[model samples]
Target chain A: MSNKEFEQQLQRSVAQLTKEIQPQRDLWPGIEHALNHEQDSQPKSNSWAFQSMAAAFLMIGLFGWLGFNQMQGGDRTEQLVTVLSEPYQQQKQRLLASYANQPALTDNWQQQVQELDDAAAAIKLALKEEPDNPALLKMLKQVYQQQIDLIERVHAPAWQTI
Target chain B: MQTQGQLVDAQEHFAERAVLNLIEAVKAGDKQAYQMLYQQHLGQVYALCYRLTADRALAEDVTQEVFIQLWRKLDNFRGEAKFRTWLHSVTSNVCVSYLRKQRGWWQRMFNLENSEAMHEVAPGSAGEVDLDSLVQRLPERARMVFVLHAIEGYRHEEIAQIMDMAVGSSKAQFHRAKQLLSEWMGYEQ
Candidate 1:
């Protein structure tokens, strides 16, 4: 057969074949059913991955908020502690500095003796106000011993050289 | 011929619009549009499943599953390629998985019809030629390549990408399928 005839034959065969294999109308119902089934089964927010992600996000957010609140609370607590404790720190510093220059024996230690007298007077007043408190009594005793030690030590002669 | 062209064109336009409509409806969980969309593409999807699995029941099952998946993934369809191509790709993947799960060579090759069953079906075309039977007779790879390239009108490159074969292999398969078809038709060299 000629090339033209052969080409025609080939085209005819293809055309006929395409028509013959075209899917039946009845098959569409099953196909549609499959499509619906597949659509139903696809991954959605209902799936485990999505649920897990949402749960993780919620947990992280809760922890983050808690941490933020605690951080703010800590800052406030530190500020209050500092404000309440500042005067006590200052009083302690004055007491400590006044004793720095006292010697074992001094000709006239009147200034050193006066500072100790004032501190002891302040402690006595505070103890009278809070009479039953052991902490207050303990502090009062510490101040008394410190004053007596300062005076006694100053009255003693300078340390003897070995 | 003109009517067929008109019908195909109308179907194409309808399919495009229907898909867009389905996208909106599916997002809103509209069952009606989903059904409409499924009806529109069912044949193509099932044909793909049937071709890949070679089992009517399995193809039906896979087709069902594929459509459900397609509905859920409608948002993911970026309109980059034709929706049909996306559908076919999904169908092919589902069939591959089913075949793998079945783990039998015969199942992989599709239920080869017994001679008696084959004889029962009348040829719809002249000269006792039934395209489906002829397609079924092709080697798995060659048949897949043929259906994708010739019937489905996919390019060799696209077929290669979809089938995970080299482009040359796809082209060779197409060439082999054409030659075989020509032989089946008893076309003289």
Candidate 2:
């Protein structure tokens, strides 16, 4: 059992080894689901960039008009903000729904997330009163980004030591 | 379940034209083309991941991750590198990132006592055992180096870059891996 002979024997054994090992399960289904999920998650138009810009302008104008009236003291900012942001709300809802059942990484992640959701709710409540506040819109976007980051981190791939 | 290396080496690189065509279609957002590529590469990718991670389910999971990444980043493939080479690079990065994310405190704690850790020995006679099973029994860093060096044909310097270790470390780990495999084979005899 000299080192040289051992090395030669190990080399021979490895040379005979198969480099391709088939998975026991049909991995195609999982891959298919992921591909489809990605397609579903993305905005579904080549013109979405222009469309989103146009939509954003329209929303800003509408919210600005509502806020102006509220300053003059009218009361429909609630309904208007909801109408303007309906699409984004649906997108967020769908995002939340997809990962709803995934396990969280930290024990306090849910509570931390709950605090973010509460902030989001409070921001929406304020938007209903003063819908055109740029600061508020920016805050809402940040909250959304945080939620997405949190969920993605929780579901991130890890080494399967097992 | 042919290896991608076999595909690359076959007949002046088998299916180079077909793979190029698939890449074109994939760049155009063809899901079918992507799936075709996935099927062609899954076994090799899974085997690579398994050797790196030493777990079947994780190998499959990482294989799926590799494809998902390929689909997302297919537009960045400029045909400068061979698709197989590009793919192995991507799989290597995906495995590296996977290892990084698993360094969470709780996971490290759990793995210390985890019964199902990669060191689990399957019940079988040594002669009946597969090379992959034996490779998985090597220590983690050694297993990664052996697969990247021996099976994947990476030079120690290249493995150093991929695994982010010194070249000598890669060489040493590879030798350690071979020695472990030798011991296992001697036991079988």
Candidate 3:
């Protein structure tokens, strides 16, 4: 084949390529986590390395230490909040599935979730740039907990009937 | 072709405007605007990383790393050129620097992949020539050159500067990539 023909063939093949290839996994979550984790420590520090395994339970510990004293006897709302905040993936998945399909009692849940999603995306992006900031990590966790609480609160049948 | 060119120009103008607005927001420390930019440009960033590394996992890491660097370096952008152009330059630098650092003298000579992920995908999945599989099989320098030049529309001079190689070497690697691509495509046909 002529060199021009070969070059054309190369161009044809290359042009057929898509400019974007979706990753096999959703990488944003990891990116967000990494950014936050790194921000809590030095660029080369291993201090926040444990954060990968320190998901929802970190909040559980925080909430328990902070506000568990306010509640008297076994408050179901507080109890369910603790359960919703659990970090164990398996248990959390099973627990969430039970309430995943229920109709929300509140009308604004979708908008609330959209706001949380946007907040989370924005936090992750910032975390991508600045990884060791404790304030950002706390904010990210709080935003996440608010999302969980919102979901649980909306679906709690005893609280409101819609 | 003319219509396509016009369409590309229009899209570019629109993107330039969006990027200008985003850069202003980001400069004011608007993290959300930076993320908006991330979502807008991630596909191309990721695609460049994957094509550069030829390993899916590494590409993901590289993609994240590029954006992280971009976030830190966002202020350096003077807006003289399109943001995409600036981002592309950053992506290229990060990927190439990574490959250089990861490759030891012997590894570069032997042309070994940093990870075994490349071999995980079969050469002919679903009974057709997998161009990705073929591209991954390419020798490292040639693959990078092919991606930058043929796929990304980079001139040999720009590639030479980016790869820190002679202009003639860049052209040679590009040719080598095409020759191999033709061979693989021919075999499939």
Candidate 4:
């Protein structure tokens, strides 16, 4: 081919090149997993702040509940706990399953989760003693929300931050 | 009734609006929105990565990394440029960074010499006369310059910035890429 023809052919080939080529595999699943894993691998110092925040929320929630109980009366705590805990547990299970393969951001993330679980169990026990107390029910709900938030922040922190 | 051109324009506008909405939803921590964005852009992103890296596996990894980083950095996108343009820039940077990390210091120092062997081991090496295959045979720097400039419509100056080379070097690499590709395609000077 002449020089001009060679240049023309190269331009033609470049123009004809496909701008999109699909991968042989579905990459979304792996990407999704990595997104979760990336958040779970953030610095450990964030974990300390997370734990402190959860503790403060719980303390505030408990004090607020105590004061509220003095002004309220109800026997629906057991039923309400059942309503909240059942769905919370199922959602927690799904979240855990979704992030099952990811390593936690901190060494003690699992322990932190366990601590929340223990706190929830203890709150449930307190609710049993005062099954009529709306305050205990409120505490249970707050604890459950905190657990969910903790799992979420660890797994997909971008969502939480925004 | 709308003319064909007007209809096409309307469709393009609608598509742009939908992508903008998806970006907003993704910024709000919507996983589904993010996934939609991924599905929409992955093919183009993968194509750029694949052509730039000339390796299928590395392209796949780079594609994933681009989307993963996109999720974290979506908040920074202030809608100043078209999302596709921003994403193309992001994908190119990620591919470059990934390539840098994959190569050892010695290989980077001798990148031009070492990359010539990449053509030998590159997939579809035997009897494939397609332009892409020929592109895969290009040395790394040359391939990147050609892909970014010729295929991706980037100016030599932009490519120089992306690759951290002088504009003259970018032009030289592009010329080298075209010459090599022409020789492989059985075109004479």
**Judged by TM-score, which candidate is best?**
4
Query: Can you write out model 4's per-residue Cα lDDT over B91-120, one digit (the tens) per residue?
Result: 988778767644423253335644655445
lDDT of 1 by residue, B1-189 (tens): 999999999999887877876768867878677777776777777777776655575566556556655655677777778777777777666655555433333332234423233334433333445566666656566777887776666788977877778999999987776666555555544
* Candidate scoring better on TM-score of 1 and 3: 3
Using DockQ as the yardstick, the better of models 1 and 2 is: 2
Measured with C-alpha atoms, the lDDT of residue B157 in candidate 1 is 90
DockQ, candidate 1, comes to: 0.05
lDDT of 3 by residue, B44-153 (tens): 99999999888887787667667666766788889898788888988998888766644433263334734354334344232244566678877788899988987788
Error of 3 at B6 (Å): 7.4
Per-model DockQ:
0.05, 0.22, 0.13, 0.24
| True-structure lDDT of candidate 3 | 0.65
What level of docking quality does candidate 2 show? incorrect
How many residue pairs clash (N, CA or C atoms closer than 3 angstroms) in each of the candidate models, in the order given?
A: 12, 0, 5, 0
lDDT of 3 at B12: 83
Candidate 4: where are CA atoms >4 Å away? A44-162, B104-106, B109-129
* Interface root mean square deviation per prediction: 34.7, 8.4, 15.9, 10.9
lDDT of 4 by residue, A21-65 (tens): 987767787678767666455653365457647655665665567
Candidate 3 runs further than 4 Å off: A33-162, B1-11, B105-130, B187-189
Q: Distance from true position, residue A8, model 3, in Å?
A: 2.0
Which candidate has the top score in lDDT?
A: 4
Instruction: Please estimate how well model 1 matches the true structure, expressed as its whole-model Cα lDDT.
Output: 0.55
